[model samples]
Target: MERFFTLLLILVLSCGLAQAQQKHSISGKVTDNTGEALTGANVYINGTTIGTATNAKGEFTLKNITAGNYQICASFSGFKRYRENIELNASIQNLEMSMEESTGTLGEVVVTGTGTPHHLKTAPVPTELLNSQMIESAAAPDFINLMGSVSPSFDFSPNTMGSFMQLNGLGNDFIVILIDGRRVYGDMGGMNDLGRINPNNIERVEVVKGASSALYGSDAIAGVINIITKKSKRSISANHNTQYGTYNTYQSTTNIDFNSKIVSGHTTFSQSKTDGWQNSPYEVDGDELVETDEMTQNAYLRRNVRQDLEFRISDKLSIYGGGSYYMNDNKRALSVKDYGLFFEDFSYNAGAKYLLSKSSNITFDYTSDTYKYYYKYNQTKEGKYEAGDYQLNSDQRRDDYNLRWISKLGKHQTITLGSELVQEFYRSEGRLQHDEESVNTLSFYLQDEISLFDDLMLTAGLRVVKHDNFGTIATPKLSALYQLGHFNLRGTYSRGFKAPTLKEQYYYYEKRGTLYLGNTDLDPQKSNYYSAGVDYNNKWLSTNMSVYQNDVDGLIAYENTELLPGDADNGIKKRRQHFNIEEARTRGFDVMVDVKLPLGFSFGGGYSYVDAMNLTEDIRLDYVARHYGNVRVGYFHHWNNYHLNVQLLGRLQDDKYYHEEPNAKGYDLWKLTTTHQLLHSNKVNLKLTAGIDNVFDYVDDVPYGENRGTINPGRTYFVGVNINFAN
Candidate 1:
């Protein structure tokens, strides 16, 4: 491979020519808990990037910085974060910061758990953050209602042909979605399109459950969800947001940012729509029960746009490029005659980075993605389909190449090296039985992190893969951390894999007269995971508890097979194919909590438990739900221009197990949110939000093709507006 990228560009220019040092400065102001004066707020000096923001009287200086004991962080994006541990040797004046409205952000900074960067209370893995004030106090409208309102071990399963994600009971091809850290492409059956992500352009959310597969390879078996977006560290910035509700649902977004002196820019636009509703219009007509207008959630529209650029050829190199465009439409059934779906996507990326000092760096990335799936045709249909005919149903493509290095080898060791390449192409011609297929993967990975002083930490990783069609593979992982004193203790062991998606081999479909087939000799789905966690944070509580066990092998599902040679000459004698599944097990437990009280009240919640099994047909894994739970309550106040927040959220689940008969009824839902920061200024900012989702009006109404729990249309109300501008 070009002499291994010319020996990694001569070892990243000999570590960017060794070093440079001598610098100092610090100054700050930023305030919030009743002292109010937090304009723009961001003040940094933790692991370099020096940083600043706060002006307009919430003052901030932080200049050249570099001499000694660090961690002087301060942040503000819906409050709560401030860290201190200074000793900068010279130049320090003023410096006093505070932030509140706490919802527990354990000293921020997380890099999706050990891909580098840690702190979310000393991470050695076992991460889960979700910030931006718990997604604007849970007035969610996207990313599947903000991961079904503040994730407690997420499981979002919506299906009418798409939607999937489950962690703890592993599914959807075993989880791994990312943005801003790449990796996010296509899926409809194995699920993607979480509406092309835009929770008003999020700024936080990071979860790392078990099996990182030696740093994200082989699909990370059931972990990783990093979606960090939203950037604007001012030179200029602009934003706009919108929202509307119930059965006419809507959301809109716009953003732009630009910085100079060496260029940086970002632009985005978003739109989403819905006119969907219905909860059981009666179904099951074999033993009698009728009436239908189809749509227990289906009526959609989506659009997204993105553009980016960056160039700063010095200060240790930088380069970047970007592109995106996406569209979606799914609206069918006012009673079915079927055929209403279409998707479009196009993506592009380019990258470069260098800075082998100050806690190292060297990165390169290239990505290309394409997705298309269609059906369209909503009118005159005859054999083989017609009318507005679009019919293409599947054609996905993806490509990626990444190279990385981060080295710090002195002062508590850190090392990481990586290389990856992946390419996939698939096409369906009326649902494949051969039209096109391709796959490739190449990987190399190594990681190390150690601290051993001031409380233990350790990480180890290794990954090696080369698969044309499942050839060599190796994965390993181990992690540990121990703090004690505000407690933290963690552990992990991993080896995970999942390969076998190309619509699980190959396919041909037919539904409602039943018949489906696929399996070109599939294999590759392996795992072994184990975990343990315990965390307890201070300054008014934060808690975490975890336990996990996974052991999967083969596991591919869809059985019944017996015909597919012209479907038994068109007699179609029982067909369903896609095999595997010999043993499976998923065990879980997670619990989390937050608290912070004293005049402004706060409380949080969590609970999740999953148990999946099928040890050679012992059963219990169909639409799994062993138990689940959720909750939240909050209040905040500060009025200098108008700032208020009130929140209440609750969720519950249980009973989603099934060998048969209705199972999928487990409910409890509530919401009441309010955020008003009317007009706060540095340059300008305004916000308003209101909500009342499902609140005491839970509906499972299940009767339309069974299995249900929440298509939530109970009590709904919403309002939103956000505006910001800075210079």
Candidate 2:
């Protein structure tokens, strides 16, 4: 009988051990107050070394946990401290928790097109995030002109022909532009001016400086700009926006949404017009105009419409699509020449997503965009010009498709696979024209997140791209994060590559009667980047500081063209030819701090320092100001009749170069915004913003053309009002 009892006891203990093993492990996600995924969050049990940091996917898994009732704590920066009691059961497997953003928290999470979302506190890379609230508060004319109020790094020059904003000292071709993870290339005269993009449709803008070809591929040697669109939520009913300011500038924006069990969608439209500033009598310091040169005040006009649709086919399958159409008319000015230019573009995007299982999913998306350009001009100088009253037209179209899959392969590993293909077609009729050149691109990437221990997470990713002109290239990235109590430290190293653009390969233009030739022998540009940062976050405050460096090779330079219509071989009035430069580098530092003070009040600010220059020329690149920063203070109050809020903005920027010029003096600006809630029955709201750009009215002698200059607009004021209604 005793022997039998002993055997029974052994069996019971064995079963208990198995049960404990099962009960101790818990896996799931932690979300923010807004239902958005919270990444790099920490979850832990009291008085134990057992803890795990959230993955890039915002998931966490705890293993070998003791079976018992325990207190769990979830902590993140710029958020309220979250703690809860969790009961462990023999059959329990996973638990999910939601954390709220601290009341009056100013700095929020930023997404910078790394295919992932990260908070400012723990993110290893230097990036800037701007939300709709900030955009609306600035109240700039268009998306590009808003540059003066938002980021100080990028200097914007308003042109009648298009919205002109240059990144750093790099030309427009060097910048990579994206909308919701998809590339959007729009250019005129070799420059993809930012003025063409409408601000009304933008939900957020993420900017990353320096070489980012590692993740986005080519056209990112200068920087990366990702524009995220607005989505319709069941809670949001309708919104209308309008603004009228100087220069006959008027803007109208509207959004409407409807939701059903099986279908939901939103439609948005915006239109704007500007009489534009004076361009004639344009000279250095606005002094005098030279003979045989004439400038005329031009106008800028645009019309845009966008639609978003979401359809739920089943519990596990869904479809989302968006389409947009943009039309713009502007004028360009050059010595002895003034031309009216028109740009029209239409784009369509469709995507389908499926949940393969509880832990895996797949998505596919396709996009097509076509651009049409028309130009009309007459020479200002007296000459027997051919093609008098000329009109030139051109068309360029692009198609892109991508497929991606994500999987959670157990508690220790996560995987992602994606493939993309892009095709381009170009045709034009003008003095400088090109036949259709189709570029075929294929890219594949794999990313994995490995959990080494309780407090350590390692992420590794590799991407390979094949281009018809550049052959094949590989980019790899590795990052590690370590959690030490309330502080987190992380480091990353990545490789970036950029292929030559069609303009660099086939474009032919004459500069001052000199013919320039395209180089089919140009090689791709490559770069290696490294970054390290430390972050601290608790209930009251969150802060981060990071330093980064980019080493680049095979950089492109312009050489005089050998062949010209008038071949004097004097080496003057020569067109530009593309050739590889030896080396170049960009280094920068970023620091951000956010404090959630008492009584629904908060303060947040960030500072960035960038030294981006050309090694070959030994001069700074133009338009990239060395220093930039933004500061904010806001307060919120809830009332039975209505909710009220007030905020202030302080923006600063250092002087920068204009391509090859020396530098422009930096300036500071200030702005204020307020909102009030009303209507107890209908859900009505109103918001107002007052901004003073260039608070000091500082004038800048902006360089233009070969050796000419003009003064940027003086101080300006903006006022905007937005209304929302729901039933």
Candidate 3:
């Protein structure tokens, strides 16, 4: 490992020194037909990776461009794309461009669907996009809640185990979450820590539904969510945001950035805390009401800090490194329970990219993630607490390495090839009988995107994975898109496979009068997914409708069984073990429509219907809703110095079904939010936001172990302030 690090460093230094000669730069401004500055417009050198977005003043600068003649393009949603030729001769170039409003969605760019970037209107697969403005308008505190509010095919419910997420009727175990194109590595009870993500630092989020195993690896059977973080272009920039809400809840985040021609750095710190709340003080134990001794909290206390640094070796080479630390503490009621749970995570990553040419690049990345859990006992013995006797419960670690190359074959095709290696280690005192366990997975994938005709596109991808315990498997996918006058029709078919997790093959524990055991002879889960969608965009209206079906075989589930061959005595009545004995199918339809009204107002909403069933057992899947929908209305007003925005959001859902528990009741939730911009100067800005969630004060008083219709803490109010400065 030391030799490898040394060799990589030497290579980067040599490249930097060899390419440190001369470079030119370009600066420009983008405006609309009426000469109004356009903020957040995309400007790039055509067919290259060198690009930048317009700042608040509609100004952008592309530095370190080699002296050459090239075509520069500027684009924005709902606007016509503009392109012009420019020549650079060892000097800076300044230019100005304007765009006209258009009734098309051809300007939006997406990358998650095919592992390559493409305009949304021309991409061969369907994808959903949520920009920063939409995320801020909803006032969501975490990533899970943010997604649940904007997308109809996504849903979330909070419980003690974790926040359960369902994407198009599939559970969290089947979804892949990526941060800036890298996978998140830790999970508890099949739920990743969405709180680790800072919403304020996110620039945009892209969602691709259906099987994506051909691009990503396992756990992508349901879909993939890629979060892109903000990058700074200015010499120096800083932002601070803070919020306070009911139940003594508090949140604060601070970010700092420094950028130069050769180096750029970013650092962010965030903290959140809540005093916790309870909806009911009693529980139904059998037929009588008994006093409860637990508190219901979606989350307790969390803190996270991350830092990243990038070095631009030249116009064709770059290197970056970053690390993050996260911690969370959850406390139960002070009644009968004598212990609480605490979690900690540490992550580090480093990567280097080499631009082979204007339209090709190769990247290599390495990442390490560690997760730890501790038990805090509130008992005392001999003038000291007994927490030390049973402090550490579980420790898990993962190391990943990835290498990718992307090349533009010609004016009509692009190809991407990548390989990934992952190593996982786990140790637990209470969950596993053995002291430690380990697993390894290696995978390679290739993707191709081709423009078949004037208005037709095709994309095909395949992946092969080799697991230490499961041998080798292959997955493939194909998609096509055809553009009409004002519509985009697309269809996809993909194969997916998910190998059993280490915990599922080695875990052993007892809870609530039931003993659970893991099986080592489990087969991997396999699925075939099919989907089709139509998108229509025009001046005043945009709509989309999609239908999808997924059929899965060898689904893993827990089943009651007789005692094992060599079972030890434990205080449990029932014995259960994980087995691949179930087959299932999930079929769903999603419809959404957004309309721009007069007077700077907009109205949009969506509805989703799903039928997830177990084919072998002839029963409905657990924790699935048959019907769900959301509605949104917004108004915006801008003056000379500031702007005011107001929005109302509502969500409705049908009853959720479960196997071992009663059905959850249906409910509706409403929220209202308003943002006021106090300052909008070129170098400084200030904004304030106020919101009320659960306006009707709806709450589910169900016990801790049952399925809850809604986990809201009744009516709550919050206020937030954000300040930004740049130079």
- Estimate TM-scores for all models: 0.34, 0.77, 0.93
Tens-place lDDT per residue, model 2, 463-487, is 8988877788888877777878878
How far does residue 557 in candidate 3 sit from its true spot (Å)? 2.0
Candidate 3: stretches off by over 4 Å: 1-22, 37-64, 73-83, 89-92, 99-106, 284-288, 381-390, 562-570
lDDT accuracy of residue 652 in candidate 1: 84
Clashes per candidate, residues 3 or more apart or on different chains:
0, 9, 0
**lDDT of all predictions, in order shown?**
0.79, 0.65, 0.81
Give the 10-residue window scoring lowest on summed lDDT in candidate 1: 9-18
lDDT of 1 by residue, 136-191 (tens): 78868878778878886886667665666677777667888889888788887557
lDDT tens digits by residue: candidate 3, 1-727: 4345446545754664553557778897899999888776778787554676677788889876777788898877567778898887865545888988753344666788877767766767688877667788888766765776777788887766467788988887788888888777777655676778877778788888877536678558889988988765556789898878899888888989886667889999999888888777776555577888667673378899999998876666788999999988767665746667678899999988877777787777889999887766756566556653447777889988877888998779999898888899999876886768999988899888899878888888888889898889888988988889889898999899888988889987776667888888898999899999999988888899989999989878788888754454555667989988578999989998888899989998899999999889898888898999989899989997789999999888999998877988788888899999999876788999999988999998887666787777899998999998876
Assess candidate 2 and give its TM-score to the true structure: 0.77
What does the lDDT come to for candidate 2? 0.65
Ranking by lDDT: 3, 1, 2
User: Per TM-score, what order, best first?
Assistant: 3, 2, 1
Better of 2 and 3 by TM-score: 3
Error of 1 at 354 (Å): 2.1
Cα RMSD (angstroms) for every candidate in the order listed: 23.0, 11.5, 2.9
